[model samples]
Target: MKYRSRTDIFASILQSANSNKGVGITTIMYKSFLSHYQLKKYLSIMLENDLIKLEEDEHLYRITEKGLRFLQLFSNINELIDTTKEYNV
Candidate 1:
């Protein structure tokens, strides 16, 4: 399998969490194909950066508006890169 960059991983995590109403840490890890340690580290950073919010009552995580915006921007950037590569620019 091709290696994924941190931005790609973050985008995957955010996309997974956004799709689910109340997503658990393990669920995100499994869906994102990340190990426990890696999930924990990324989750912490996402929470701290306001990309994802944790629900204390249910212990579930949800993506925020900012996170959605980040995903959109990331997708656009990736598309731009691909387009450039296609033209050998």
Candidate 2:
């Protein structure tokens, strides 16, 4: 597994948090395969950046508008890459 920094962590968090169903740390941790130490550090940074908001219950996280916008762009790039790869193969 690759070691990810705060920026990398935020990208995943932003993406996962976009859904209205909300997301949990465990899911993010699993999806990103982040270590406990890295998860805490980056989660705090994501909150500071306003990319995600913690639920009052402290069990769920939601994406902010800023995060959604970033995710939308990221998703577009990912789709484009997939399309290109498909054509190449």
Candidate 3:
């Protein structure tokens, strides 16, 4: 995937995680087109910032409320751009 797709991948993953459903890092890595090292680095930062939580039992991850709020803000920004594009203004 192109590098820009990384943003969309993150938004999708965070939306999924917002459901409080756990997700696997492998899946995220694959979908985001990120290498293990890159994913690990970003994951570490997100974890440290309390944006995501890990489930020890299943080795899964979920987004925290802060993450969800951030994702929502991103979505709103995307919507604005999409709407502007439609207007061709």
Candidate 4:
């Protein structure tokens, strides 16, 4: 796999969380291709930034509305960039 930028890793974690109702740390780690240590670091930032929430009752993580918006905006930007790349040829 290509080296993923921090933004790419963040997006991947969010996508994995959004893919399910509520997922555990291990689930996100595997889906995001992150190691436990890396995931812990990212999850800490995500929680602090309100991008994701940990549900203690279920021992799971869920994406927040802010995170969803972030994903949508990121997707829009990527689409625009890809469009430009296509035209650059």
**Which candidate's TM-score is highest?**
4
Selected candidate, larger TM-score, 1 vs 4: 4
Best by lDDT: 4
Cα lDDT for residue 56, candidate 4: 93
For candidate 1, write residues 1-89 as lDDT tens digits: 56888888999999989955779988898899999999999999998999999998999999999999999999899877764344533
RMSD after CA superposition, every candidate: 2.6, 4.2, 3.6, 2.8
lDDT of 3: 0.74
The better candidate by lDDT, 1 or 2, is: 1
Between candidates 1 and 3, the one scoring higher on lDDT is 1
Q: For residues 1-89, could you state the per-residue lDDT of candidate 3 as single tens digits?
A: 33455556567556655645688888777765677787887788778878788998989988998888879888898877864344544
Off by over 4 Å in 1: 83-89
Which residue pairs show collisions in model 1?
Answer: none
| TM-score versus the correct structure, for each prediction | 0.86, 0.70, 0.72, 0.88
Candidate 2 lDDT (Cα, 0 to 1): 0.76
Q: If both were scored by TM-score, which would come out higher, candidate 2 or candidate 4?
A: 4
lDDT value, residue 62 of candidate 1:
94
Location of the lowest summed lDDT over 10 successive residues in candidate 3: 1-10
Candidate 2 colliding pairs, count: 0
What local distance difference test score does each model get?
Answer: 0.89, 0.76, 0.74, 0.91
